[model samples]
Target: MIEVTDHDGVAILSLNHGPVNALDLEILTELPTALARVADARAVVLTGEGRCFSAGVDLKRVIDGGAGYVQEFLPALSTAAFAWFTHPKPTVAAVNGHALAGGCVLGAAADVTLMSGGTIGLTELGAGVPFPTVPLEIMRYACAAVSSLVLTAKTIGLAEAVSIGLVDQAVIPEELMSTALKHARKLAAVPADVYALSKKQLQQPAVQRIETLREQDDPGVTEIWGSPATRDFLAEFMRSLGRK
Candidate 1:
């Protein structure tokens, strides 16, 4: 589900699941380990191999009672994303295509981001579930790029996404990888300790926000995830998938 290749001192991690790169328990469980292997590199670039970066967790997996398949699911996902967010090395999300829900969060979690100008959405409202608890640090970064999304159920196009600060740059699809690597190399050239310290300073306030919310979010998250309304919404959302 996760594949990694190192180029010079840069580590490139690609999402490899088939058909839209839908994230599932397998990917969720193993991604952290893969990320750990390359966490010490000078830089990291995360991109998907196919048409979409990811469509978030596989709906079918959840609908078919695959929930228990991941005993530590949500925590693992939150942790994996955090690992990327706090990586000592710079991390860039190379968005080649659509990135909805979890995929969108993954893109926003990066230290820097580049996109090919495609669809990106946080369609949790459409699915009738509570939005992900959104670590305060992640929310600040993601909001710059996609704040309007939190206000309503909508899919963000590339230009609008960039205008709002959801993505740093949008390039032609074919140039996405090269663009990402170019920036990654530039970031890699920064003095290690200096760069890491600057990055940490930028993220500290957000991290504090996340810690605060984590304590207050349990009630809301539990209600949303376990609600009958959410279950019904999930079913309908799956059935309506291609009609969009």
Candidate 2:
């Protein structure tokens, strides 16, 4: 579920699993692999096909696999996202549509985020799952008023995303790709080594905090995922969406 295309010196990473591009095994595990393939590229543009950048984690997988699936999946997800968040190049998120929960975290982790008149939010608290630590750090770094918002798992529209700094730009749907490409080209002009090293330095605090939280909290998160309450809550969420 990842598609890569090269243009000039930029790599376009398109999420292509399905209509919503829900975060799943392949998308999580394959994303850094996609980044590796584009190591020579000057910049990267991450986006999605169909109606969403991503709808979040695959609920069906949670329902089907229970604690066993989550134990491995959660760590892998954190690992892959950590790799991308610290990718040593200019990267931009071209948010074409809805980016909920984990998808919202991905957008926030990027160097810059552009939204195509879509909604973005963190809804994990309401969904009865422990928000993973790395993504939580990404959100706090990107969004203003995040302390209150995270507690509520607030979802915001495009205007709010821009206002709160979750999105750097909000473009009309038709212009999203063009605008993102423009940013990619502009960013690619920066010396790669300087950009990479400086970025690491600038974000070192958040990065360090994320690492600490990942180490200290992943087991607890995994345990919560395995809880009967989480299962019931997740099952209810599926039923609410009429997913069976």
Model 2, span 78-138: residue lDDT tens? 8777877889989999999999988988888889999986688888887888777887887
In candidate 2, the residue pairs with backbone N, CA or C atoms under 3 Å apart (3 or more residues apart, or in different chains) clash, namely: none
- Local accuracy of candidate 1 as per-residue lDDT tens digits, 1-244: 7899988889999999998898776787777788889978889999998888887777666666534533345566677777778888888999989988788888888878788967987776677766545533575665764446855758889998888888889989889888889999999899989999999898887777777786577556656665556667788888787678
Model 1 poorest ten-residue lDDT run: 65-74
TM-score of 1: 0.92
Q: Give the TM-score of candidate 2.
A: 0.96
Off by over 4 Å in 1: 66-71, 135-137, 145-147
Worst 10 residues of 2 by lDDT: 140-149
C-alpha-based local distance difference test score of model 1: 0.78
**Every candidate's lDDT:** 0.78, 0.86
Residue 2 of candidate 2: its Cα lDDT?
91
> What lDDT score is found at residue 71 in candidate 1?
33
